[model samples]
Target chain A: MLKELDPLLHSQLRLGVMSLLMSLESADFTFLKEKTNSTAGNLSVQIDKLSEAGYIEVIKSFRDKKPLTTCKITKKGIKAFEQYVEVLKQYIK
Target chain B: MNDEKNLTPQESLEVITSMIRQAKGNMKKSSFYFLLWGWTIVLANLCVFILIKFTTITNPFLVFGLTIPAAIISVVYGIRQGKQITAPTMLDNINRWQWTGFGFTCFIFAFFGQRIGWQINPVIITMCAAPTFLTGIMLRFKPLILGGIVFWVMGILSFLAPVSWQFLLASFAVTFGYLVPGYMLKKTEA
Candidate 1:
């Protein structure tokens, strides 16, 4: 029997954000927006959702007197992503 | 990028691969640090070689003082580049620490290698190989890996050569280990 996909990481934007975060040490809001080709409003909402799920950590700090939001994948997020990929591979096979 | 109800496994795999590729793409820009140090060290090595061979100067090592300016330039350039980066990736962290450690090793060698009566050339070249080799492995760049190997081999050989010829060997070592790979990195950026 096939396992269910990770609901938090199954959607388009959230998955993109998680995948990007997985590869990086930490990424800020602007970088994520640029890479995902996402608008700030939509990206903020998805980031919030992921943050709420405890799949990622969001840190807000000031850089050069400007606010910066940096996102990094949590350990929970890494486990989720790995399981998601394992299930994905099964379906692909 | 549009929101969808459910993504197929293939689409999910594609997303992961595509985003990873995009992240890696950001690292394509050349830092030019290698090129700067390559030329500076090459010049210093040759200057020392020439002074010892031709001039009546008692201290040929004075020419190495030129590296002060080189170090300043590297610091300024590094700060400028750091400001432009939006985020640090894993590879970036690794590369930064690798070079930092290498820099510390060089500093130690510069200050103590002479006091211990150790030949500085072989030690310098051998210590320099660590960062270059690690960087090549991380970036999957073959030229740098080979260059690192060249440095190691030449560094060992430097011990066997005559003292005067050791300077020439140092020159050759940096030319291949740094200059060649430095230019190759620039070419990849282009």
Candidate 2:
């Protein structure tokens, strides 16, 4: 069954970030930026949005003296992703 | 800063949302390696467990606890994985650990068993404790990390327990390591 998606998460870029997070246990901002080929500013903006949504968590900490920003999928984020995939699958058929 | 900025609050929010969605898509495309590789480690560990339980398993010392034999197997396994299980960032950290947790578990049990006899270490607890700890930090989950910490502390304290205490540690290891966390993984679906 196709389920409702929050309009906020349906955007092209934001959906990309959430989709990545939903599949992974965690990832860094740079990795996400590189994978998406997104500008740093744009990636930062997207991460902030996901963090704000409580769909994903942004953990800021230091490792080996470097400022580190890591992201992980929240339980809510997983549910949203499963629902998102189900909805998208409908279009494939 | 506010006066120079032209975007309305709602407009900015929408922009951010769209950007995140795109990033999520990219992430999905890149993570196939982790899912496949991580599952392999989990499966291999389960296989070893089954093999040991079913086989003659003459040497409990070699088969269970912190044994060098198990660590040897893990190091070879971990090294074989090489870059496929890269753990450069906190995100990759969990992936990096892979089967190394069991390696440590094998080492602790092996060393302890040799001199101290076939007793479980209370503080050492679960062989997977260290890996779980890394996962917690990488995932930014406090409870999971705390659970690892508790298991580790238990491992260290195992040495202090009387002869009977070894069994207690073994039981606790299963309870905290596989049972509790397994339940959580199922319930939370995380």
Candidate 3:
């Protein structure tokens, strides 16, 4: 039997965020926007969805008096990403 | 990039690979500390060699006092750089701890070496090898690994050399151990 794909991570931008977070300790809003090549408004919506799903934690703070948003994957997110990849391999192979 | 579109499995994998590559590429490092320490060590070794050979300086160890300024500069530089980055990678944390450990070990060796009547220079050269080697492994930079091995070899040679000449071996060790690899790290991204 094939595994079901993670609906939370199946979309392109969310998966891109997850993949980037997987490799890094954490990344800021600007960094994620740059890497995802997404506009602020759209990226914010996707980030909120992922946060609501408990796949990522968003930390808002200030750097040099400028507001900063940093995102990191949760343990639940990692498990979901791994399972997503495993299921993806089944489809691609 | 399409933010809301569904991705095919192949496109999904591609996005994963590309994003990971981009993150890795964004890893920032400054060669300032490496070059600073490398030049300082080389100069300290040379200063000792010069004082012992040409001058009638009674205590050549006074040259090592130069490290006081180097340490101050290091601390200031570290603080400034720490403030600059919003996020530090896991590798960055590991590197920081490893070097901090090395710094403590060196202090311990220096403090105890005199009491134990141990030759400090040769022992210091031996101690230098561990951090350089482990750093190489962490960064996947081969020159640093070789440089670490060079420190060990130089350490052994320093043991065989006469007391005054151990300074010369130490000079060679830092030349290869820190400066060469330091420059290479500055040049290479990975």
What overall lDDT goes with each candidate model? 0.85, 0.54, 0.85
Query: If both were scored by DockQ, which would come out higher, candidate 1 or candidate 3?
Result: 3
Each candidate's DockQ = 0.72, 0.05, 0.72
Per-residue CA lDDT of candidate 3, range A1-93, in tens? Answer: 877788888888999999999988888888889878999998899999999999999998888899889999999999999999999999988
By DockQ thresholds, what CAPRI class is model 1? Answer: medium
Kindly provide the TM-score of model 1 when superposed on the true structure, using C-alpha atoms: 0.89
DockQ preference between candidates 1 and 2, better one: 1
lDDT accuracy of residue A77 in candidate 3: 90
lDDT of residue B21 for candidate 3: 88
- Clash totals for all candidate models: 0, 35, 0
What TM-score number comes out for model 3? 0.89
Report the lDDT tens digits of candidate 3 across residue range B1-190. Answer: 7765778889999999998888774555656777898888889989889998999988888778787788789889888887676556777777877787887877787668778674888888998998888878877789889999999999999989998899888888998988998898998845
Worst 10 residues of 3 chain B by lDDT: B25-34
**Candidate 1, B1-190: lDDT as tens digits:** 7556578888888889989888875553443988888888989989989998998999888888877888889889888887667867888887977786787778787778679674788788887887888788877888889989988999899888887778889889888988899898888877
TM-score of each: 0.89, 0.41, 0.89
- lDDT (tens digit, per residue) of candidate 2 on B1-190: 1112344334434444454554432211122222332233334434444554567655433323233333455456555544232113324544455545554555556566656555534434645577666655555555557767766766666666664445545555545554455455445433
lDDT of 1 by residue, A1-93 (tens): 998888889988899999899889889899999999888998999999999999999999888889889999999999999999998889999
Model 3 Cα displacement at A49 (Å)?
A: 2.4
